[model samples]
Target: MRLGPVLHREGAFGGAGKRLGLGWDVAGTVDATGVATAWGVGDEVVALDHGMVKPLGTHAEYVVVDAGAVAVAPRATAAAHAAHAATLPLNGLTAAQALDLLDLAPGASLLVTGAAGAVGGYAVQLAAHRGLAVTALARAGDAELVRSLGARHLVTDLAEVPGGAVSGGGVDAVLDAAVLGEPALAWVRDGGAYAGVVPQSGPDPVRGIRVAAVEVAADGARLAELVRLVDEGVLTLRVAETYALDDAAKAHARLAAGGVRGRLVLVPGAGS
Candidate 1:
């Protein structure tokens, strides 16, 4: 979900008198609102900003979003997997922001903590696409999957490379998408950068490295680029399962259980 400082009252999960849809991702067609010049009526889109529309709705047939918070979704796979597109915005944008913060040179090395998770998965792919060598910290079983995503190296346990043993001194930067907190900062080289998804934990700088927490903002242009990656088969979205909108409680339970490969989606017209 969209998060600001705990002291900040406006957030996706806070400052709420009423809450509508709880998800941070959504994919659907624009209603009859032809006023949105970038998105016309009936245009399929994936809405971001943690799905916090003004009136607060996404699990229903209609959702209101800022004009800049949506990207045109590709039609090739939308028919079969519209729900999958719903998983892109929050995690995908977070990943994109993490990479942008790093800004490493081409052929540089990167370490992505929690590389098997949603945001980390995209980070790995995008890092690879940027010509950076990626070392993915994932479970043993995800080795092949991460390898396919362009990670040149894999470490099953973070402890194995406490101080960047995987790449001699350390990687050029780290994208800590799994919220590994300060502990993951050890993987970066001196003068390198670390971008964490959760800032509340407050990572200390190590060995002259720069550290920053990523806050995903709505950018329709960037989202459109990500969508194009999916359209071209450069990035892949995984869906753990789908539930009817009414079964959202059950979906939350499944998420809490953990070990989910991708995302859990709720469809409006589907049955429980």
Candidate 2:
């Protein structure tokens, strides 16, 4: 999600970006019974906000997640199996929200950039499930991955696409998960909509299109819907690679390499 350019000058603090940087969304285990009275110890959770008061994170073992931010992990989803799902909730929610802004009804066409990444994964699936024709654009070797998510069309290069999409007809909306600054805006269909994890420089719809950034928030009800998809086998989590928590630096390197193809998770010690 696009973070606000927080400005702290003198004794005054102000947030830049209309609705950016709501907070962080994280996941971990409930180490205590305090924050969320409804949550309990041993419940695998995903949460939003800061750990200090709002939402505890999953950056470590035995994290103190806020109860309001917690959700029981899908049955059989071992906490140690992957961090993909742990990191998925926030990004997935962001993409779902952005797609909804397009207001395209079922059977409409939608385009997605960076289909190989975490948030991009949910974009493809949700759009498809809503009966929209999904066209996924990603790096080479990512075609098959996005295809499994219900994308009808796929492309390796944006240059190969015409009219803002691979199908040559363009799509009703463009979900630009891979923000590359200003030049990336060219992918949106003329008079359509553009959405990204980063806020667009132009707030208004360009060429009669709508443009906006996504900020993920806490929503148990939405999380349940996503989990239901996983339970029913409509959605699948992909772990590109795993690393020990101590090797988080290495994990970051792998993620920056750009061909990892899925979520890179950190595993705690003792074979967790």
Candidate 3:
């Protein structure tokens, strides 16, 4: 089985008082079935065990998830790998759901902060695929990367993004994947919308700008669509490193050090 750990800030997991297993994304072959369902033993699958404080998480050698939360894994291809597929469920779903909250139409202008990051990267590609004009805000070095991901405009510095530029006034919407908070909200025009990755933690609505945060949920059907995109080469998955289950702490430390450009995966029984 393959797993990916999400290292979130304090209270991101609801301030759980007890120790909890640490994983959200999992990809592996089904080992058994609880009932007569579409899935069977030896079937390749992926799932999002959606929760913040579960006693056990997908990091284990085995996991039990609602069948509805599981989907057939992406077919292996030159562009897709099991490790890369393991990074999809959580980040891909989060980006797609956040964009749904924006509800922007084709040709609408959108700015995505931290465009080089996982959720932001997917948001860039998906927004562009939907025909939105995407301007990515990322580090200067990532300009080409974000542009390659379908960002039409690139701004290395927040100061370079002028207010009231898109749609004759700020961009139509902002996807604050970088969690820039109030500063990012200021880029939205009046009556525009803002969607954030952190639930209920976005800046308050101002100037008639509608604001909401995405609380990611598991939707197997939706995940299956994303898998199709990956197979079609419309989406890209990046893996920064892999660690064995026993080296989870080291993975956490690597994450804390920052500069990670992709997801960190954990392979059970594999060497660090």
Candidate 4:
């Protein structure tokens, strides 16, 4: 598919040495390649192939990708699907794989930091759907929203979780989306685990607690399932704002200003 709108994330890997046009999340239309049979002509798809410090052209008008990297979104209108496809790949997969690292049993308890953000928000919902009792730590304003997403315990701050000397003593696992670093380790039980998105900044293991740094990989099958959930209303994606490609810097600025609940999308040209 030719690239159209791409998603912008702050503090993403490869940001220090790079500028725009290096984003991994993208929503675009199928091109005229003979390989369009699976995706079809005029199909709206989300193609994820951008990598850290790698060749990334999704910010431009076109990006060459294999069929395995893209997923067609038929359930949503153009604008809505742009928002969904722009987000479904990276954050959704991160949340899914992060929870997989926890390997929690049914009825297990989980604490998700930054529960109002994109990855954390989806983690809250997906974990809850998997029968894990989720405790969401986010701003007070997002309490009701997180609760509706299936977070049982709502705390405005991570400090609300009492620190314990050992693992398996506090919550069962911690999905550290807020980048709490070592401080989040105290919230996990003696045998529990801590899953962080950033590997280099992940906490050191202690008290028999496992530390896992989640690495997101593109799985078209997984993306398709996530899209189905979105279409079925089981999963809801939020778009904080949409900007034309030329105004991508503005989207980055808005994301940097903080308190964004969803993603910032960059349309290739003039956007609605």
Model 4, residue 184: what's the lDDT?
Answer: 75
Q: Per-residue lDDT tens digits of candidate 2, residues 137-163?
A: 886677777898999988887766556
TM-score of each: 0.87, 0.79, 0.93, 0.88
For candidate 3, report its TM-score.
Answer: 0.93
Can you rank all candidates by lDDT, best first? 3, 1, 4, 2
lDDT of 1 at 143: 93
Off by over 4 Å in 4: 1-20, 34-37, 79-81, 162-168
**lDDT-better candidate, 1 vs 2:** 1
Model 2 regions more than 4 Å off: 1-28, 49-57, 80-84, 162-169, 181-184, 199-205, 270-272
Instruction: Return the candidate ranking by TM-score, descending.
Output: 3, 4, 1, 2
Q: Which candidate would rank higher by TM-score, 1 or 2?
A: 1
Winning model by lDDT: 3
Question: Residue 100 in model 1: shift from native, Å?
Answer: 0.4
Quote the lDDT for 163 in model 3: 68
Whole-model lDDT per candidate: 0.77, 0.64, 0.84, 0.76
Please list the Cα RMSD from the true structure of every candidate, rounded to 1 decimal place.
3.8, 5.6, 3.5, 4.4
Model 2 TM-score? 0.79
Model 3 clash pairs?
A: 164-169, 164-170
| lDDT per residue (tens digit) for residues 115-191 in model 1 | 88788889999999999989999999999989988899899877766455433377788898766766677767778
- lDDT at 176, model 3: 89
